[model samples]
Target: MHEQLKQQLEHAQAGDRGALARLISVLESGGSDAAILERCLRARHGGGYTVGITGAPGAGKSTLVSALLGEVLAEPGRVALLAVDPSSPLSRGALLGDRVRMQPHAGSPDVFIRSMASRGHLGGLAMATRSARRLLEACGWPLTLIETVGVGQVELDVASATDTVVVVLNPGWGDEVQANKAGLMEVADIFVINKADKAGLDATRRDLEGALASLPPERRPQVLETIATEGKGAAALWQAIRDHRAAITASGELEQRRLAQVRSELKGMMDALLANQVQRLFEGQDAHARVLAVSEGSLDIATASDQMLDLLYDQAAGRV
Candidate 1:
């Protein structure tokens, strides 16, 4: 199985599009490929920046990302896009219609666009996204843009994964309130008031300024306005992104955030694994009987919990 998986990964790394799709499928299914994905992650050398674009629906995040891609590709490096769509609960499939908006770049040799379904994940991110990003980076794609499903609050976790986070919002959309509620005002390295041609642009800018005013001078984010469809102000937005990157790098915050994200992800993985193992250990066992006894008042709840803990400890110590 490992050999077969290795061959698939090798094909993917060699730029076989079908192999790449298969590799993503394998990882998303969550078993043997999980180990393979971990190995691939460990083998990755540093690549281009990963920028996460997030905002509420109708904020023009896709248009903004497409424009930004143009700016990024002007520098002569490969760019990959991971557009995560909301999953349909009824069908358990992606509403991949958003990828249609980016279809023009599908044929660009320097650009690779993939639409990933959120797979019922609450964080507006695909469960397999990190692995997919690693795969793209390993395949020589220097830059990755992760465009998350624009469900406001859920975007925070997705933003934490990227090097620079661009929170895109449009004018008169109650964007300021949403930003504050989502805690986006805090996490955004670069805030973009997209669709600047719309009404209330100045008011939106002022609201953003007011929000920034509360933060310390050193921690305030730079804000830019863009009419993404016409490519207006894209240069300024790109420059702001670069400036944010430079600032974080100079302050050593970039490496610190990376290390912290790695640690958080590792801890989450370990906790999930432990929980799964514990669940399996109790399945079809006397644990259910103990629970029933405790519920029926024949055994105390505390005593039952203690016994379960003891059982877990014994199993960990190889006593069971």
Candidate 2:
């Protein structure tokens, strides 16, 4: 297994598209090979810039991303695009509708596009995307564009993972201002008023500008208007993102932010591992019997919980 992973990693590094696809597939599924691959990639990782584009559905996020892809690829370098879509509640599979919208760059060797279902992650990103971004960096892609599930402004994990966060909004976003205050406002490094050809554009832009002006000058984000379908403002938006990245790099804030995210990821992993163990224990016959016993009043809830805790500790210790 180790030797096979090594070969795949070598091929991916050497720019073999098939090998890189296999590597990304392994990482996306959170398979057995994933941790090994991530560790290997971590050693070779020269960090690249990740830009996260997030906002409400119908905000033209896909169109903006398509435009930005053209802008980014104008300079020669590999780019990886992850279009995260909402998972089907029953099937838990991605609809992958974003891929159809991004078909313009389908054949670009320097551009690799992948669709990921959020898989019930309410944060609007597949849980594996951070690892995938690192894998992209290791595979020699110098830039990654993460387009969120477009569930709305509440999606913040993509912002946490990326170096720059671009929040896209439509012309009628004024009424949603209060709801967005907690989500997009805090994460946006740049605000994009997409679909500038639409009528309420000036009003939407002012709403954004007014809210931004009330903040301290240093915390203000750049606001730009874009007609994504016509390819109107992508270049300026890209430049704003680059400028923000450069500013954060010189300010040492980028390292500070990434360190915090790493700690968050580690703690999240530990919590999830423990939760999965507890869940497995609950699925066992003995645990089921205990649950039925509690329901029948033969066992109290508190006592049953104590017994479960004991079992958990025993099981964890045995594994250790």
Candidate 3:
């Protein structure tokens, strides 16, 4: 690594927010430097607890996150928030509306807030969010909050990336059928009924309860109500978070989940590398010739694919 990068990492570990921001920017940009930085911090990662908040748009997720910060900061240690937002079609940059809503804590030395663009990535999380979380962990932030972009039925990448997944919804969110169809049910560690002051609170709670009835009592996520706009129930929500963490940690589930996450990340990296290699192989002269032959009916696609695989194996074996 470069001298400046090394100095920045050291400064970040010592709690220099500016240096930490620069390091995260480098990771988001991605290259050899980012790879080297990740390698350097590999042993130091995984210190903090990460919480993910996700829900449909207009669910007041940003407001709930801001409200929760008050409860989180009431204690001693610093916390970091990574808010993911939709990308602008023109610039592909974060809209940053979440940052605006969370500006109350922006000036605090102990609060670090970052807004990331999803950039058309599936599952409502930015591609760089995982790396940023690792960087925050290495820097000694005891708690990290990840607020995902507006998600509907299927966006669930946040669950794989965090320790706890909080799924937010409004009082009149939907019927039991819709709740059951949403993939959120599969990953939510806690269900937050934000805007609880609105109508249909009881009905919504019942629907959620019914949808979750299949899970064993010990496995069911608690459904909490909150009026985030008024900061109502924030303290209780934080307490519930703490209780859930304690339970998971004591049962050894926390460590298991983290190990599973590392395994999944490694698999994703391998898939990406393999995809790149496959693309390169397809663009090679021999593969192009095979493609032409197959298209001209002089060779079958199966044989052509076999030949390409043979060529790839030869290249890998240093016999090309």
Candidate 4:
């Protein structure tokens, strides 16, 4: 893996489009190529800032992300975007049209856009998103945008992954009452009232203002109005994001957040590894036969669970 990926990483860092795409594909493939990724990161110290764009569905998130990408691309640095869409159950691949909405810079060499499948991952993000973001950053994209699958209040793993989280809402989103209810209020560093050209815009703004009044000054997010389709408020939104970036960087919260992300990611990987071992046991013929017998009343769930645990322990002991 190291030898195969070395040239690609070098070319990717040098702004080769095909090489960059290939590197991103490798990361998205979720292969066990840790050494390759490690080498890539070693080539670049911290590169880009990531902005996580999330909110309820129908909030014009894709439109808004496209507009925001316009803002970022106007600058001189390279940009990469990941638009995560829900996966088809049969194919386990993205059922995507999100990328279609962002055709404004479709032909730009400075911009790279990729769509990823949520693959049943909760909290609106693809399971491989963090790795992909790292790859983009390593490749010298100064700004990476992640557009999530748009899950609602109950889930928000995106917050743990990015430097900033922007929550976009449309007018008439329960008039600030919904703001307090959804988990969006907590994670948002910048709040965008998209589709502001619609009716009830004033009402929504007031409600959001009222909701934000509860938080202490520094922690409260900046709320801006945007009609993303016409690109009316994207520049202001970008400035607000820049301000938030400055605040976090000046306050040392950026490093703190990255450290927290690293910890969470490491723990998640360990848990996934352990679960995979247990799952492999369940997939085996012997375990499957035993479980079938349990279902037939020849054994009990408690016995089956105990046997699984014993196998897990044996595997752990073997690793030791």
**Candidate achieving the largest TM-score:** 3
Ranking of models by TM-score: 3, 1, 2, 4
lDDT of 1 by residue, 99-124 (tens): 66677677887788877754432222
Give the runs in model 3 whose Cα sits over 4 Å from its true position: 43-46, 89-94, 118-127, 152-155, 174-180, 313-320
Taking the tens digit of each residue's C-alpha lDDT, what string does model 4 give over 9-112? 88887888788777666655553663356445632266688888887777888888888888888888777887765555456443345757877777888789
What's the TM for model 4? Answer: 0.83
Top candidate, metric lDDT: 3
Which regions of candidate 1 deviate over 4 angstroms? 89-95, 118-127, 175-182, 313-319
Per-residue alpha-carbon lDDT of candidate 2 for residues 1-320, written as tens digits (9 for 90 to 100): 88899999999888887898887777665645766776686622445778898887778898889999999889877788987655553564534457777888979988999876534331224457776777778877888898875535325775667888998888877555457666777788899999899999888888779888877887799999999999999999989988998899899998887887777766765675677788889889879999899999999999999989898988888952
Q: How displaced is residue 168 in candidate 1, in Å?
A: 0.8
lDDT of every predicted structure (CA atoms): 0.74, 0.78, 0.80, 0.74
TM-score of each: 0.89, 0.87, 0.90, 0.83
84: Cα error in model 1, Å: 1.5
How many residue pairs clash per model? Answer: 0, 0, 0, 0
User: Which sequence of candidate numbers ranks them by lDDT, best first?
Assistant: 3, 2, 4, 1
> Which parts of model 2 have CA positions greater than 4 angstroms off?
89-97, 118-125, 152-154, 174-178, 296-300
